[model samples]
Target: MPSIDLQETGLRALNTTLQSVEQKDAAYTITNPMGAHAIACGLTHEINVTIEGHAGFYCAGMNQRANVTVKGHAGVGLAENMMSGTVRVTGNASQSAGATAHGGLLIIEGDASSRCGISMKGIDIVVGGSVGHMSGFMAQAGNLVICGDAGEALGDSIYEAVIYVQGTVESLGADCEEKPMDEEHIKSLTGLLALSGINAKAEAFKRYGSARTLYNFQPDNAGDY
Candidate 1:
């Protein structure tokens, strides 16, 4: 396990080094990946990469068959358009954590900002903390489970995506509604919480999502508006 000291090298050097590695074969233990941009883009192999600090935009964009773990906070678009494999952030994440993700699992141990899983596709996002407004907006296919509270207008303009919030929500988006907690949901949430290392009881969490009415269009059913 060779360590790539990010302090010694800058973002350009990091990109060059990652690009130069063999596809789906080489592994790296990158230290001080501090705010490096596009750390592992378009990877295609069973590569295991560990980033030991804060990462900037698009840290693992277009990833494929690569397991990348971030030990600290990440900037926007953490795993944009990820094709496969897993990307785990051990700390808090910024906006658009898993934007347009195609497939794979994204785990965030801390809070994630707005639009956590925007326009997602077949990607499973698990956030251990709260998420800002408009999370899961325009999400196509996948599951977003937030073990903490969710901000305003969650799951707006969603599509085939399921967002399970265990805490309070400021407001539900168009077509979004609170549903009855069933045994299946509880089972799924239990496993998910355990995987994310969250000790909270699954039964204590409440579920909310689109009512399937606002999926196609937004309707003003409320008189308050």
Candidate 2:
């Protein structure tokens, strides 16, 4: 495990160290990484980068196969548009976290603000806390697992995305619906939780997703939407 103190190191030094990292057994630990933007962006190597503190926007943007973990809260778009691998935030996340993520596993152990997982393509988001309104809006394809409460207008205008809510949903979106929990969903939820190191009973959760009513433009329902 290679430890790099971000306090005594520049962002370039930290990033350079991470970029040159090729050892899978190495844990490039960065301590006191406060609000460092693009800390590990465009990393194609398979490595584990752990930050002991907070990070700024696009912290792990465009990542290919690196796993990044933040032990503290993260700013907006924490893993914006990540390609592959995993990004885990142990604390709360700001707005638009994992926005437009194409592929990856984004695990938020705390509450997330609005537009979380907005416009996601194939990323999977598992949150242990609540999420703000309008989540999964215009989502193309993905899975959003919220173990806590959800704000108003959840899953608005969603498309081909599966949403699992364990708490109260203030309101369902334009064409979303609450569906019955089945064995398959329970297995899926269990897998997602286990992936994020969360322990919960899937039967205690509820599922919500697009009703396929607004998949295409509709005349009667499209007025308000």
Candidate 3:
């Protein structure tokens, strides 16, 4: 395992070092992040990275096969557009967490701010706490599991994505509606909960998804247009 101190080496150099490493299953510890942005973006190898402090925007954007863990809070767009692997935030996360992600898993142990999982594409997000408004907006494909309450307009204009919420939702967004949780959904939720280490009953969650009402042009629904 190697350690990189952000105070001694700048973020650019640290990321460059991580990018340059060709060893398989390497591990790194980053110290003194001090809320720096883009700490470990674009890592293509299978490695383990642990950040000791808070991180700024896009901490692990576009990551591939790297297990990145943030010991503290994260700024906006944490794990944005990640292709594979896992990014875990032990603390709270700012807005747009996991936005536009294509694959992999994003686990947030604490609360997430507005627009969490917005435009998500084929990614899986598990949030241990509440998420603010407009979450899953325009989501194309993926799953968003929220263990706590959801703010206003949850899943606005979402498409083909599945959302599981354990607590109350303040409101539902356009073309989004609560669906019955069948046996398959329960099994899936159970697996996701176990995978993310979230201690919640699968039966307690309610599913939400697109109603497919807006998938095509409806002449009778001209009032919405």
Candidate 4:
């Protein structure tokens, strides 16, 4: 295990060392992050990184095969465009928490602001607390599980991605509607919750997805466009 104090090492050096192939499988402890931006971005190795304090914008962006844990809150774009592995935030996250991420899991133990999983491709996001409006807007694929209440226009203009909310939803977005919770969905939610380590029950959640009505242009539905 190695420890780096961001106050002394600077953000550039910290990211450089974490991205090194020579440090494969190493465990690193970063102290006094003090809300620094891009704390551990672009890591391509199977290593463990622990950020001991709050992190600023784009923390762990473009991450691949690395487990990054933030002991405190995370700022905007947390784990944006990540490919694999895991990114866990023990506290709340700002807007666009997992924007455009292609794969892997993102676990936010606390609340998340607006656009939580916007345009997500294949990532699985599990939010232990509430999320703001338009959480899954334009999501092309993957699953988003919200353990708490959702704000207005949840899953706005969504695509193939699925959303599971355990609490009340203020509203549903255009082309997004609540769907039946069949056995397949129950099984999937069970696995996702288990992976996230959240104690919420799968049966308590309601599923939402695209109605496929906006896939093409139609004069009758033109107003929705």
Cα lDDT listed for each candidate: 0.83, 0.86, 0.95, 0.96
Ranking 2 against 4 by TM-score, winner: 4
TM-score of each model, in listed order: 0.86, 0.92, 0.98, 0.97
Cα lDDT of model 2 by residue, 1-225, tens digit: 778888799888888778787777467888878787777777778899999898887788777789999999888887889888899999999988888988989999999999898988989999899999888887888789999999888888888878998889999888888988889988988998888898777889998877888656779866686
Residue-by-residue lDDT tens digits, candidate 3, 1-43: 7899998999889999988877888999999999999999999
**Each prediction's RMSD to truth:** 3.3, 1.9, 0.9, 1.3
Off by over 4 Å in 1: 7-26, 215-225
Candidate order by TM-score, decreasing, is: 3, 4, 2, 1
lDDT tens digits, residues 1-225, model 1?
A: 768888787767765677667656577888877687887777767788899888888988888788889989988999999988889998999999899998988999999999899889988889989999889888888789988899888888777877788788988777766777799989987887776676778788777666676534346756544
Candidate 2's error at 215, in angstroms? 2.2
Q: What pairs collide in candidate 2?
A: none
TM-score result, candidate 3:
0.98
lDDT of 4 at 171: 97
In candidate 4, the residue pairs with backbone N, CA or C atoms under 3 Å apart (3 or more residues apart, or in different chains) clash, namely none
* Steric clashes per prediction: 3, 0, 0, 0
